[model samples]
Target: MTTAERIAAAPTGTETAGHPGPLAYPAARAAGCPFDPAPAVDHARREQPVTRATLWDGSPCWLVTRHQDVRDVLGDPRFSAEATRPGFPFLTAGLRELITSTSSSLIRMDDPEHARLRRMLTADFMVKKVEAMRPDVQRLADDLVDRMTDGRTSADLVTEFALPLPSLVICLLLGVPYEDHDFFQERSRVLLSLRSAPEEVRTSSDELFDYLVRLAESKQHEPDDGIVSRLVARGELDFEEVANMGRLLLIAGHETTANMTALSTLALLRNPAQLAKLREDPSLIKGAVEELLRYLTIVHNGVSRVATEDVTIGGQTIPAGEGVLCTINTANRDDAVFPGGDTLDVSRDARRHVAFGFGVHQCLGQPLARVELQIAVETLLRRLPGLRLDVPFEDVPFRHDMAIYGVHSLPIAW
Candidate 1:
């Protein structure tokens, strides 16, 4: 059966073979509206708000769907981010194995350790530090557009422009050679695929891990001006630890921003009036980016956290040792916070979105991401005033099967 059909047929608070079964977590989005959250998720947000759902392993977890409840759960320390904790929810067996078998990054650690590791890279992504890189980011975006459109009327924006921009910037920052992007990008795809086997995830992750380790070790002798070199010079972390941190940065640094760029362009194209507003007033680019982030929350799988202590949320008592999935995509659509939330409005004040997540574990690279999106969307519109999809809207492939939500490839013409 197709994904949408499977989701439709899934037991929602229904009895199955004399046993009650919860609706499936990570439910598929409605087939036609690829940009919105799963229809079941939206129903839960408006109806139950706090209800139980079953994971791939048939494990039951609380699904916190309301706007305030999602924030409360994510912000509360009682909910642990540590993935190895018992009852911790995993969307799929492969993801469970991938995270548990690898060295924990800041995303998977609680306070003290998470704090310590996060501190090492705080200064690098600080507002001022990232702001200083704006000129370079703008130049890179302009240069990419020039090269992409030099003599071409059509191209796959994903490979030609969107993917390369962030990859180039991240390589320069992390000291990884950009020419080797093919190797890492291929592995990253495997790592992010929901259908990848546990062994496939392990092999791909190990390959990337080994590559980062070698790069980190080399930096020890001949240091450069990159984050890895700086970390090795300080000697605060062992080479393996440094590699673990570098691996997270390298994959996350480029993937999220690249997908956002391509997807944002597609969103604006679908909403012509919204795109026209930005073209008329360049100042709206910043807010437009925020609105787009809220409208297309690309983290399709909700954030996972297991409760360390009994907690009451959305009038539901979640006992200690239970797992909770904060449906941020649904929360972003809550009308309580964002009126007319489903529609894309460039003028809307959407800075309150949980797109980068919330609380201490909130994305460490948000400053850099915001700047990159602002420049990317603005530059593209400014340079390609005639930009339009090269194919029918329904023909564009969406990343429904992948962990991240975005277009698989965006073909465009100007």
Candidate 2:
């Protein structure tokens, strides 16, 4: 078949046969979230849902798609996250090593190691602990709203507020100086921007580590009552481990929350009736948060995993050492799961969605993220009663190529 014919013959909304490889994503024009990933993932799920892909540098990996498949792989102990082992199907040699390193923090660990590190902070992030943060979240939200009405017709909500609120909140939780937060916020933003150079991401990661190293050293001398202080108090976590946790808090705490906040706002604004409904009745804040998380699934490049032993999911076999890519975006929109997958139904029960993920490795900071989002979205509606986009929907900058699916800027006016 001609290359064009091969491309044409490839079915839509399902995975085609054989190993399509990493080139499948089409990075340059890859549409980020708040659009649709289900089509391609659905195609994969229905056909060759579990297939191998050759990395650009020529390593092979499997991409797992179906809902049950993702859960099974993530739930099973055989699918190891220890990329340190040989024959691991890494995206690229450098990234594989970078992602798999023990120094990389909670995201890469598997089983006992993952459980041990995550438990240290899980209690602090529990819903009750996060609920106590409501007042603080409200204050931050109000402050951001207060800043928006000062003669600016439209503001880049992502920067002036969405980004800073979580960054500042996490810093406070870690006892880091608020004044020094811009560096963390900026680097995190840059690191996630799809357009950024690889060196930029590596540098940003290094800068965060450097900052954490200094902060951890200080905590050793004079620890306070934040999460980091607890790690220091136990004297069990090494500087790297503590810094890794700190870095995790800095990156994970803000990046996904920021994207979700902005994307959900954009989604709501596009649907004026919904926006008006939210504005008129702030009681829907909880429902709105779930709907937003479900409909948006802002963290687009769903988590990756590699099988340590052969595993079977949905009647298909994933070889003992192949990578798996879960489509949170696709799974959240599955027609079988969500009756009308494409439509945004705020009133619908979105709890079943996998925005914060599922299984043993679900997000530890989900409660914290919820409070921040609820405050930001609800507060924005109440404060900006006449909020409307200053530019047309198409004019808005959509972040498509990056790992995180979000908007670059949402220009709105009251």
Candidate closest to the true structure, highest TM-score: 1
Question: Which residue segments of model 1 deviate by more than 4 Å?
Answer: 11-21
Candidate 2: residue pairs that collide: 13-42, 13-43, 14-42, 14-43, 14-44, 15-43, 15-44, 32-400
Q: Candidate 2, residues 1-414: lDDT per residue as tens digits? A: 432343344444324444353324311222333366634455665566665544445565666666666777767778776666555554333354345433657667786888888888889899998999999889987887788778777788888878888877888898888798778878776666655665666777788888988898898899898888778888888888899899888788878888888888889887777777777778878887887787788767666777777778777787776666666776777666778866776677778778777777788899998899988888888787777888888788887755678888888788
lDDT of 2: 0.73
- The global C-alpha lDDT for each of the candidates, from Candidate 1 onward, is 0.91, 0.73
How many clashes show up per model? 0, 8
What TM-score, over all chains together, does every model reach?
Answer: 0.97, 0.89
State in Å the error of residue 369, model 2: 0.8
Off by over 4 Å in 2: 1-23, 26-34, 52-58, 86-97, 100-102, 193-198
Error of 1 at 169 (Å): 0.9
Lowest summed-lDDT stretch of 10 residues in model 2?
21-30
